[model samples]
Target: MRDVLGKLGAFAGALLAVAGVIAVASFVIGLLSGRVSFGGLLVAVVGAALIAGVARLGKVPSLLGGYSALVYLGLFLPIVIVVIYAFNSGRYVTVWGGFSTASFSRALHDDAITSSILRSFRIGLTTSIVSTLLGTAAALALARARAGVRTPAEVVILLTVVVPEVVIAIATLIFFVNVGFELGTTTMFLGHCVFNVSLVTLIVRARFLSMGDSLEEASRDLGAGPISTFWQVTLPRLAPAILAGGLLAFTFSFDDVVISNFTSGAGHETWPLHILSALRFGLTPTLNAAATLMIGVTLVGLALAALALRIGSRQGAADFSTSTT
Candidate 1:
């Protein structure tokens, strides 16, 4: 029954791929006649390629590949739809008048949107830096400590991860009020740092454990002090993980709405906060354009993080091999 079903699925996927290919070919022909714009033709080509790729996935040896294809569609189809609509000519987000750059222009030109975005970036960058520094230090301490000390500390730190974000936000708000600190960007930065430190600590500690203490010990044996060893040897090895943690922190800080809302002072709105407020008014294609830009930035950050990790691993391997030889 499973094998029969798989065959049927593959046949359906193949049919879809053929349809996409034909549509793309028609768009290309129209492009040559100056009937189709280059952007439209490019989009058609990419869509057809994606459809063919999925169809190829469906034909893989196991059922897992087919399942993955379904998951991919479910996850990204809505995003693709929204991205397509971001270029809508009309003010209404859903009603597609045609491909237009008006929304992109409005979104970029709007003073509130641009200012909020700049504010968000400032907060995100500040939070990530402070959290990364503190977390890296904590991770080093915990990783080198005795089991009795490390185990309890690990649980305490990871508790932040397990706790709900809303709960954390509320707790932070109460703490700020009790401490007599006015809710503002500083408070938001503090809240973000608290959560991100634990995240960074976990990532850095994992990397430390995996890489072992050999390099640090070698540095020490060569008469480098602890600080020098850490700066020269340990930190370089942990650079990829640290970068990944910082990127994660930046993303979370930038995207945070609930916490930012609870803690933001008068006249201080982050980009997410601006979007949330805009939703109360009818959503516009401008909002969609903003969202699409945010998604693009996030994807770029993730790609860089992945690339950094890959390069760091290769460099570490090369260094280890040279040392051994």
Candidate 2:
């Protein structure tokens, strides 16, 4: 009976996938002809959902792959559009003129854009540094702390990350205003640090927990002092996690718009804020170029962070194996 049901579900999933592909193709063709195909889009969406449901029920790998591809297309299509349009020679963002790098050149030469980009970079760098230092210290303390103390600390850290950014932005704004602190780069820096510190702490703590204390214990047993053991043993092993956390913090800080909007004072527009302001008039290919550049930087940061974490994990495994031997 189970085999019969699975076969039936797989057949249904296959039919739905075929329908979805046809609908999607029709929608794309309509889009290219400047026609809105809501019916086709609706059909595609419904088909995709049905196929996914059937795949889940039947354990059909092909159906699941089809659904995942559709989902990825929806998510990345806009990014693809933006990147393609960055090379557009036309003044407007949506219209396709001939392909050229003029937009990038213009964006680079624009003083306001350049200044905003630099300001964001500076803020992100500062935020990452502060967050990494404070977070690493907190993680170390938590590792040694009693459960009663560590539990609350962990909850607070998680709250900082999980709380709505809009709420954090509004609250930070209110606090700064109430205290008579001027909103500008300083406030933005501080606001970014508030949450970024939590991100770093969580990452470092996870790495530290997985690392265990065997190496540190061995160092201590070898007649090394507390500080010596930390510098020679713990610090070296913790470095990759620290670097990963810092990169992640920097990416978040650079991409932050909600917190930056609330905290940035007059004349201190970050790159995102600058883009927002430019939207009042109209979007240009230059903005697309700027966005593409930002996207590239963000991707690079995230990639580096992942690489660092991977390296750290391997190092930890090697260290553990050696210690055991």
Candidate 3:
């Protein structure tokens, strides 16, 4: 009876979610038409209440209820917008006309777009590698150290993580201008690296902290040299955290606009710069198409990374638990 109730609750929650989504859509449609109706919003709220109620009954998995939902946001919204625009034939992106791929062709053939994409990709890749390597070192150094050193290391990590992106971007740009530093992709890349290094460090270190201390002790007890122990023991164990942190850093560098906007000099444009400039001239199909592509790539790639890591971590833990049992 309880199992049946659970399944029923889950189904009700799912249906309520669908209704809530439809209501939100109706509200948006009404909003775009110059006046939003309370009726549509009321319907959405009611549906959301039902969904929340069912979710509270303990039928829905928290992963589904929370983490997965949060993670899917970037993927879900972008996909919906991209699909809508992919079929839009009109010159204007906002007002739909009919289905066509003309905008996509323009985006592909655009030299400036291509150049910016290449620039962003190169920067993202380089930044990911450099940041991950340095950050992981910092993470490992903090994670493996004695108790006395850990608190300071943690404080440093927190400062970087919590600092505002705009502050760093503006500060770096000013410093460059004052010192006569040549502003280009290289500077942008390095600027991104600064934030990314801290981000990666904090993420990897968090993972390291979650993993208990037994492995390192075991390695030490085996009379293995520190280097050999780290290589054979710690690195393999730390690989997942490293990879996760690196993926996050790569995505950060790829999607960054604020920092890139401030640092990129005249005549040199990253994809973000192109998009931002184009927006001032009004929205275009080409911009949507290009943006759609980046959004899709980043969302799918990152989602897959998240899914893979989640599964692997769960399986590894399960295996460890079973063996211990």
Name the candidate that leads on lDDT: 2
Judge candidate 3 at residue 225 and give its lDDT.
Answer: 84
RMSD (Å) per prediction: 12.1, 7.6, 6.9
**Local distance difference test, per candidate?**
0.85, 0.86, 0.81
C-alpha TM-score for every candidate: 0.78, 0.78, 0.73
Model 2: pairs clashing at backbone N, Cα or C within 3 Å: none
- Candidate 1: tens digits of C-alpha lDDT, residues 7-103: 6676556556655766788788787887877777776877688676866676555434555566677799999988999988964678878898778
Q: Which ten residues in a row have the lowest lDDT in candidate 2?
A: 6-15
Tens-digit lDDT string for candidate 2 (227-251)? 8987898888889888879988888
Question: For all candidates, what are the clash counts?
Answer: 0, 0, 0
Give the range of the ten consecutive residues with the poorest summed lDDT in model 1: 59-68
Q: Model 3: per-residue lDDT, tens digit, 12-106?
A: 56656666666767777778997766777787678667656655654447325443444466567866886678658985688898888888898
Off by over 4 Å in 1: 1-8, 11-61, 304-325
Model 2 error, position 101 (Å): 2.0
Question: What C-alpha lDDT, on a 0 to 100 scale, does residue 209 get in candidate 3?
Answer: 86
Badly placed stretches (over 4 Å) of model 3 are 1-79, 144-148, 303-325
